[model samples]
Target: MSNSPTLGYLIPQFPGQTHIFFWREILALERMGINVALFSTRPPPPGLISHVWSDEAMKRTEYLGNMDPRRAAKATLGVSPALWAKDVLREGRVLAKDLAIASAAAQKLKESCAARGIQHVHAHSCARSALVALLAQQLGGPTYSLTLHGPLSDYGPGQRLKWRHAKFATVITEKLRKELPELLGEDQPEKIFVQPMGVDVNALIRDVPYHPHQSPQQLRIFACGRLNIVKGHQDLMAAIRLLRDKGIDVRLDIAGEDDDGGSGYRKELENRITELDLQDHVALLGAISAEEVRRYLLSAHVFTLASWHEPLGVAYMEAMSCEVPTIGTNAGGVPELIRDGIDGLLVEPKSPDALANAIMLLARNPKDAQRLGQAGRTRIIERFNCEKGAELIAREALDLRVSEEI
Candidate 1:
C-alpha cells in the first residue's frame, strides 16, 4: 500500500452467478496491482456461491444488510440527519428504503472503505447499488460511479438520481448506451460509455478437445442459463420439437437451476417436453458446476439460447469461446457478440423455425459448423476479451481518481 487509495465495490450480491464478469474484472484489476474492497448489501442467493472463485470473494466481502445492533447504532449515529433526509428526498419513494437505511449506514460503509483507504466506489447495478453509492456520497464518503447493466425499465426512477452526481455511468452494452439519454434524460450522453460484460476468451477456449462431427444418429444440443420465461427456454423446446419432427435425431441438454424449485417456469419447461413426447430426447440437467458447463459446451454439436431479452449473455460468450457453433436471438447485446451467418447464427426472438433451421444447418454441415465456431472464438478473443475490458475499466477508474481527487 502506497499513498494512493483502494477502490470500493458496492453491490447487492457479491458472488452472484450472473456476475462472473464482476469477479473477472476484480481479479484482473487486482493482478494489475489495484486494491479493491467488496461491500455487498445482500449475501448471494442460495446456490449462487458454489464456485471456488465465489467462495474467495465471499471471504473478502462485508454484508451491510446484516449489521449487528451495536454496529447498527454506531452507523446510525454516524450519519448526519439532515444529509440522510436529503438523500431520502432525492431518492424518492421507490429507492427511499434502500437509500434511507444505506444512507444511515453510510458511515459504516465509509468506515470499512476508509479502513482500506478506498477513495472511489464503483457499483455494479444502477438501482440498489448505485443508490448506496449516492447515499454514501451524501454522507461525505467515496466519489462513486455505476454501471448500467440492463434495460433501464425498472431503474428509470432511481437512475436519474444516480446520474445527477455519479462520476460516470458505464453501460454494459451498446443497446443500453443508446437508451441512456432516453432513460436518464437527454443530457447524459457524455456520462455514458459502452462496456460489455466480458469473458476470458483465450482461457475459456484454449486447448479444449473439440467434439468431432457427430453422426446424424446423435446430435447433442446444449443450452445453459437460468430456467426462466425471459430466457425463452420454452421457445427453445419448441425448436427441439421441430428438429425431432424432421427426424433429425437431436438430443437437447438444458443445464440450469429453476427460480422456484421447478414450480413455476421450470415446471412449464418439463411439462412442455412431456407434452411434446420428447422427454427422452431432452434432459434437464439442473445446475451443474462451471467446469461442467465448460465440458458441456466443448462436447456439444451446437449451443443455442433463444432468449427474448438478453441484455448480454455471458453464456453465449462462453459457448462461443468454447468454439461451439452458437445460436442466439437478435436480442439485446447478443447481436454485438454474434455476427449472424458469419461467426455464428442469429434467429428471431421466439422463432422456433429459424432456430431449428439454424440447428439443422449446422448439424448436417460439420465443416460449416467448425468454420463458424472458429470465427466466433477469434471474434471473442479480439473484441470481448475479459482482460481488455478490465484494462479499460481500470484506466477509467484511475482517470476518475485523478480528476475527482476525492
Candidate 2:
C-alpha cells in the first residue's frame, strides 16, 4: 500500500459526471493508499485535492467561448463540401473548443504535477481533458491515460489527437472500445481498454427484502437523463400522453437538467406536456444529486431512459441497484446491460408508441416488474460495483505507466 504510485487527474471541468467517475476511481486507489491530485479548468469543491488557475485562463479555455465562432463559421461553409471536409466541419467546432481547453489546462497541470511529484495523469473523458492530460504529460513527462464516456459529439476534431497522445484509454463499454480502433486505427488498439462505469453496488442495493408499494392503486414510473432531443424525453412524454388518452392512470417523474445542446428541447417538452394536459400526471424534477436520485428510484416502481443513443446508461445501473425495474432504448451499450424482458425491457429507440407500450405492460403487471427489478439488482451486484471497476482501472493505470517505462 505504501509503495503504490501517486496520480494526477486532469479535466477541463470538475463536479459533473466526469468528476464523479474520476473521484470514485481516486477513492478506490486511495483505499490502497495511492495518492491523487486533481487539476481542472474550473475549480473543484472542497475535499478534493484540486489546483485552480486564473480566471483569464478559464475564459480562454471554456468550451462555449471557443466553440461559437468556429461553429458559426462551419455553418457558413455550407454542407456540400467533400465527405472529409463535411466530417471535419461537422466535428471541427467541438475539436476547436477541446483543443483550446486542453491547451490551457495542460499548462496548469504541468505546473501542478511538477510541484507534487505525481507519476501519472488520467483524464475522465477523451476530449478536452485527455488533450490536457496529454499535453501536460509532454510538459511534465508523466504518463497520461483517458477514460472515454459515450456521446462522441464531445470528442470531435481533437479525438484523434487525444487518442494518439494518451498512454492508454479506458472506455465504459465494449461497444465503445470496438468503435475506437476504427476511429483511431488498428495501431492504437492496444492502448484502448474496456471498463464499465460502475456504481457503489453494495451501498445502493436494497438492504431489506423486496416490498411492493403497499397501495397498488397508483403506479409510479421514472425516467431520467439530460432533457434534450437525443434523450427522447419528447417521445416518452408523447407515450405518457398516449397512455393517459387510453385512460391508464399513471404518474411519471423525469429528473435531469434542461440544457441539452441549447436546442430549447426542454421547453418544447414542457409545452407538449401542457398541450397533452399531463401537468398533473408528469413531474419534472431537474438535476438532483446522486443520493437524492437514489431516493427517487426507491419511491418508483420502474426506471426508464429512452435516450436515442446512449453509450452506457449509468443511471440505469443505479436504478437497477436500487431494485427498480428498468427500461432503456436498444441503442449503444444499453443492450449490454439489460437482457430484454428478463432484467428489464428494451424498446425501439425514438418510438413513442413502443415506449408507451412497454411502460403500460410493466404498469399493469406488478409481479413481473418486481421480478425484473430483483433480477437487475442481482446482475448489478455481480458485475458493476465500484470496487471492481476501481481495481481494474487502478491496475490498468499502473500497468500503463510500467509499459511506458519499459
Candidate 3:
C-alpha cells in the first residue's frame, strides 16, 4: 500500500444524492491499492447532500472554491501571459466569471498536489472541473485526465483544448466514445477508453426471492431520477394514468427532488399530477439516500424510468442489481446497458402507451418477470459492476498497458 500511487480524484460536487457511483469507484480504487486524494470545486447545496456517507466524504474532500486572494493572485500571475491569453480565447463560450473561479481553483489544486506529492489527477467530469484540471496542469501541477459522463455539449465549450491536453479520457458509453473522433477531429486525447459507470452489486441484492405481483391491485412501480423535463417524469406520470384507466390499481413513487431542493420543476410536476387527477396514485418522495432507494426497489414490483435521454443509467443498473424487473427507454446509452427481451425491457422514448404496455406485460406474466429479474442481477454481476470499471481506470491511470484488450 505504501508503494501504491496516490491519485487525485476530482469531482464538481463531492457528495450528492446521485453520486453513489463516484463513491463506489473511489472505494474500489482504494481496495485495489490506489491512494485516492479527494478534491472538489465546492460543496453541493445542503438539500442535495442526502447520502449517509456524505459527511465522511465531505471531510476527506478539500474544497478549492474559497482561495486566499494573495495566493490566487500569485498563482494567476505565475502562468505565462501568452498561455493565459490563449486559454482566454480557448474558453470563449464559457462565462468570464466562471473562468476566474476555475483559475483560482487551479491555483489551489497546484499547491495541494505539490504538498501531497500526488503525481496524477483524474476528474470525474468534463465540465468546469476538467477546465480546472487543465489550468492546474498548466501551472505545473500533477498531470490530469478526464471522464465524460454525458454529451460534449453538456460540458460547455473548450472541448478541443481540454481533450488535446489531457493524458487520457474515458467515456461512459461506446456511443459517446465514437462521437469524440468526429467532434475533436485531430485534437483527440492519446488514450480514449469506453468505460460505463457501474453499481455495487454485492450491496444491492435482495434478501428474498423476487416474485411478480399476484394481483393487479396495488401494483407498485418505482422511478428514480432528477425532476427535470429531460428526465421525462411527466411521461411516466401519464403512463401511470393510462394504467389506472385500464382498471389496474397501480401506485407510482418517484424518489428524487428538483435541482433547487424542491422549488424548481417539482411544482410543475405537482400541477401536472393534479391536472391528470393522479393525486392518489402517484407520490413524489423527494431526494432519498441509497439505502432508502434499495428498500423501495426491494418492495416494488417494477422499476422504470422514462428519460427522454440518459447517458448511461446507473439508476437502472441499481434496480436490476436488486433483482427488480426493470424497464428503460431506448435513449442514449441505455440500449448498451439493457438488451431488449433479454436481461430487461426497453421501450421507445416519450411514449406513455408503450410504457403502460410494458408494465402490463410484466404484471400479467409472473414467470417471465422472475426470469428477467434474475437475469438482470446476473448481468450486473458479470459485466456492469463497479469493480470492472475501477480496473479499467487503474490500468489507464497507472499506464499499465497489457497486450490484450480490456
Candidate 4:
C-alpha cells in the first residue's frame, strides 16, 4: 500500500447519471490502497448530473478545462509543427480543435500531477480527455493511458495522435481491441488490454427475492440510459405501444435525461409518448440516482435497453446484478455480455416487433424469467464484478501492489 503511486483518474464528466461504474472503480482502487486523484475536463451540466454521490465526486474532482492563454501557448509551442501539420492533414480539421483543448489543459495537468505525486494518468474516455492526458504526458506529466468506452468515431478525430504514445490502453470489448490495429494502423499503442467497465455487484444486490409482477395484464419494464437517438428509447416506446395494442398493459419507466437536460431530445420522446397514446404506459424518469435505479430494478418485472449500438452495457449489468431478467439488443459487444436465451434475452436493434416479442416472452413465462434473472445475477457476480475491473486498472495502469488474494 505504501509503495503504490498515486493514480490520476480522468473522466470527461466526472459524476453524471451513467458514471456510477466510474465511481465504483474509484472506490475499488481506494480499497486496494491506491490513492486516486480525480480530474475532469469540466463540470457537467447541472441538470445532467443526477447521482446521489455527484456532489461528493464534484468536490473531489479537479476541473482542468479552463484554458490559460500563457500555458496554452507554451503547450502548443512544445509540440513540433511538422507533427501538428501531419495530424491536421491526416485526421482533418477536428484535430486542430482537439489539440487546442489539449494544449490549454496540458501544462495545468502537468503541474497538478507533480504537486499530487501522481505517477500515472488514466483517462476513462477516448474523446478529448484522452487528448488531454496525451498532451499532459508530453508536457512532463505522469505517463498516461486510455480506456475506449465506445467506437473510436464517437470520440472524433486524431486517433493516431491519441494512441501513438500512450503508456498503455484498454478497450471495453475484444471486438474493439481486435479492430484497433486496423483502425490505427502503424500508430496503434503497443499495450492495449480488453477491459469492460462493471457495476458494484455487492451494492446492487436485491434485498427481496425477485418475482414478476403478479398481474397477468401488466408488464413492468425498467430501463436506464442517457436520453439520445442512439439509445433506441423510441424503439422501446414503440415496442411498448405494440404490447398495449396486443392487450398487455405495459408500464415502462425510463430513467435518464437528455445531454441538454429535458430541453432537447426528451421533448421528442415525450411527444412520441403522446403521439403513440402512451400517456399512462410510459414515464420518462429524468436523471435518477443509482439507489433509485436499484429500487426500480428490484420492483420491475423486466429490465431492458434497446441501444442501436452498445459497447458492453453497464446498465444491463447493473440490472442483472439486482437479479432482474434483462433484455438487450444484439448490438456491439453486448453479445459478449449476455448469452442469448440463457442469462438474458437479446433482440435485434431498432426492431419494435422483435423487442415486443422478447418482452412478451418474459412477461408470459415467469419461471423462465426467474431462471434468467438468477443466471444473470450469477454471471455478473462471477465475471463482471466492479472490484475485479478496478483491480485490472490498478494493476495495469497504476502499478498497484495488489494482494494475491484479489
Candidate 5:
C-alpha cells in the first residue's frame, strides 16, 4: 500500500442493514487511494455479521463495546483533565452520559488508529461518533471532521459543540449546507461542505437493469426502511388499503428489519396488514440483504418510502438507479433527490390519501410511469452515483488532513 496519510472513519454503528451507502463510499474512497480504518461506538447486532459486506466490515472494525473494561477505564482517565472539563461545560447537562462513553472510546479508538498509521479521523453524524472524534482530537490522536445528515436540531446543543471542534464538517443536502451557519451557530459554516451519500449507480444498472414494461400487469410496489413510526409503514398500509378498495390491484413488499425500534411497531404493522386483509397484497420481508433489496427494486413497478423527517435516503437512489420509478414524502432531502414530475413522485407526509392518489396515477398511466423510471435512473447516473459523491468527500478529507498538518 502507498504510505499516504491514513483516514479513520468513526461511526456510531458499523455495517447495519441501512449503511450500505456508507460501505459503498468507503470502497470508493479506498479505490481513490485512501486507507480507511473503521471504528464503531455501538455493539454489533445479534447473530454477528449477516451480510457479506457487513461480515467483511466486521473483520476490520473496532467497536467501543468490544474494548476491555480495564483498558477503557485507563483510557477514560488518560485524557487531560482540562479537555474533559471543557467537554462537560460545552455539553452541559444534556449529553453527559453520551459524552463520557464517547470520550473513553475516542482514546481507545485513537490507539487503534495510531497502530494503523491513521493521520485523520472522520465520523458520520453530529452526535456520538462526532463526539468521539472531538475527544480523540483532545487526546492528541488525530484531527477530525464530521458529516451531518439529519436535522441538526435533533443533535441538540451537541451539534454546535461538534462544529466548534471538527476540523471541517460535511452536510448531505444543499438545504442543510445553506443552513449550516444557523445550524452550527458559527460564522463561516461553509467550512462544512455539502456531500450527499449515494450508491454505486453503474454497478446497480449493470446488475439490475431496467426491465421494459410488459403489457398491463398488476403493479408491484416496494418500500424499504427500518420498521418504525417515522418510516410510516402504517400510512403505507392505509394507502395500500385505498388502492385495493379502488380495485387497483397492487402488491406491496416492505423490506426492513425491526430492530429495537420495531418492537411494538412491527406487531402494529402486522395487525394493520391483517385488518386491511392485505395478506395477499402485502408481504413484510424482515431484514433483507442489499442484493434482495435490489431484486425488489428491479421487480417493483414503483419504489417508495413515505418517511417523516427523513434525511436523504439511499434506497430511493438504489431503486431509481435500476430504472424503478420511486415516491417519497416531501420531507427533508427527498425533494433534493426526486424531481416531482420528472423522475419520481413526491407526496405529502402522513397523508395516505395523497400517497394512494400518486400510486393510482402511476398505476393508471403505465407509459408515464416507465418514462419517470427511465428519468430517475438517468438522474442517479448524472448526479447521485457513489463515486461522484465519494470523490467529493474524499477530496475534503484529503484537504482537511493537509490543512490540519499545516
Candidate 6:
C-alpha cells in the first residue's frame, strides 16, 4: 500500500445517511494507513470529525433568478405549484451552484495537494459532489473517481456528461451497473464498477446477543430509513395495521428524519396511525443518532424495511451485524445482500399482506428467527466488513490510476 497517495473524499451535504456511510469508509481507509482528505459543498455538523481540508469548490454560479412569474402562469393554468416558482427554479440550481462550489473547492484542493504532494480525488455521489470533483480534476491534474447511489434514474441524464469525464465510477449494486451502459451509452462500460456499500461488522457485533421479543405482550418489529416515498413507510404502516387486526399485538418503531420538512406525509403517517387505531402500537422516532440505532437493533425482535427500491441498504447490514433477522421488500439490490430463507426473508414490494405474514411467521417462530439472525450476523462478519470494502475499492482505484498513466 502506498502511503503517499492522497485520497480526497468529497460530498455535497455531509450529514445524511450517505455521509454517515462514507464517514465509516473514510475511517476504515484512514485506519488502513491511507492518507485521506475530506471536502464538502457545505460544512458538516460541528464537532463530528475534524476536517482534513475545506473551501468553496466553485463561485459565481447562476440559477433561476426569479420564478414567481412562472409560478403565476402555472397557477393561472390551474396547476397547484408545490412552491413559489423560485423554489421550483432552484430545484436544479444545485448543478450550477455546485459547479461553482466544486470549482473553488477543487482549486483549494489542488493547492492543498501541492503543499502535501497529494495524488487523487474521490467523490461519494455522482451528483453535485462529483460535478465539483470533475471541475477540480480539470483545474488540478489529479485523477477523479465517484460512487453513485440513489435518485438513480433521475441523475442519469444530467450526470452523463460529468461521468464521461471521470476516471472510474463505483455503484452500490450490480443492478445499477447493468443499467449504466444503456443509460450512459455502451462506450464507457470498462470505467464502471459494481461495489456494494459495506458495513462495519466488528463495530456492529455487540458483546451481548440481541434479546429477541423484549415484551411478552408486544412483538417488537423495527424498520428504519429516511421517511420518504421510496422507503414505502406508508405501506409498512398498512402492514402494521393488518398484523394488528389479526389479533397480533405488534409494535413498530420507525426511525429516520422527515426531511420533507413537515409536509403532508408526516401528517399523513400520523393520520393513518389514528385511523387504524395503531397509536399505541406504532412509534415514529424521528432521526436518532447512529449509537441509538445500534441499541434499537439490539432490542428489536425482527428488523424490516418495505422500501419500493433500495440501492443497497446500510440499515439491513447493520441489523444483520447485530444478529437481528431482516425482512425487506424484494426490490433493487436487496436480494444481493439478503439470501431469502437463509439470512433473512424477502417479501414482495408494496404488499402489506406479504410483509405482515412474514412478520407474523417470524414473530410466532422464535427458533427460526434466531437461526436466521445468527446466520445473517455470520454472513456480515465474513463478507461486509469495511476493511474488505476499502481494500477492494482502494486497489481498484490505484489500478485505474496506474493504467491511465501508462
Best by TM-score: 4
Q: For each candidate, how many residue pairs have backbone atoms clashing (under 3 Å)?
A: 0, 0, 0, 0, 0, 10
Local accuracy of candidate 6 as per-residue lDDT tens digits, 1-406: 4544657666665644434566678767766666676665564333322222212211211111122443333223432233123332644655445444344455555555557665677777776566555554565546778787864565522466467667777888877777776667743525677676678886787777655553356888888887777898888889999987888788899987555544536677888889888899888877666777887888889999999988779889989989998998899889988999999999999999999999988887888899999999888887777666576557766552322322
Model 4 agreement with the true structure over 1-406: per-residue lDDT tens digits: 5565688999997777789899999998888777789999899888888888999999999999898999899888786776567888876777898888788787788889998788899999888888888888877778998999888888988888888988888888888888887789998878888878888888999889898755665779999999999999999999999988998878999999999978999999999999999999899999999999999999899999999999999999999999899999999999999999889999999999999999989888889999999999999988888887788877787565467432
lDDT of each: 0.76, 0.68, 0.88, 0.88, 0.78, 0.69
- Please give the RMSD to the true structure for each candidate, in Å: 3.5, 7.7, 2.5, 1.8, 3.2, 9.1
Q: Tens-digit lDDT track for model 2 on 2-37?
A: 355677666655554223444555566666566666
What's each prediction's TM-score?
Answer: 0.89, 0.81, 0.95, 0.96, 0.91, 0.80
Model 6 CA lDDT for position 82: 32
**1-406, model 3: which lDDT tens digit per residue?**
6676788999997787789999999998887778889999889888788888999999999998786787667667876756545645756635344556688889889999999888789999888898789888888998999999999989976677778889999899999988888889888888888888899998999998787988845899999998899889999999999998999999999998888988999999999999999999999999899999999999999999999999989999999999999999999999999989999999999999999999999999999899999999998998889988778877777764333332
- The TM-score between candidate 1 and the true structure equals 0.89
> Counting only residues 3 or more apart in sequence or on different chains, how many pairs clash (N, Cα, C under 3 Å) in candidate 2?
0
Model 4 poorest ten-residue lDDT run: 397-406
lDDT of 5 by residue, 227-282 (tens): 88899888988999998898777889998867653465688889989999999999
Worst 10 residues of 2 by lDDT: 45-54
Residue 347 of model 5, lDDT score? 95
The regions of model 6 sitting more than 4 angstroms off are: 1-4, 43-102, 186-189, 211-215, 260-264, 398-406
TM-score: the better of candidates 1 and 4? 4
Model 6 scores worst on lDDT over the 10 consecutive residues at: 56-65
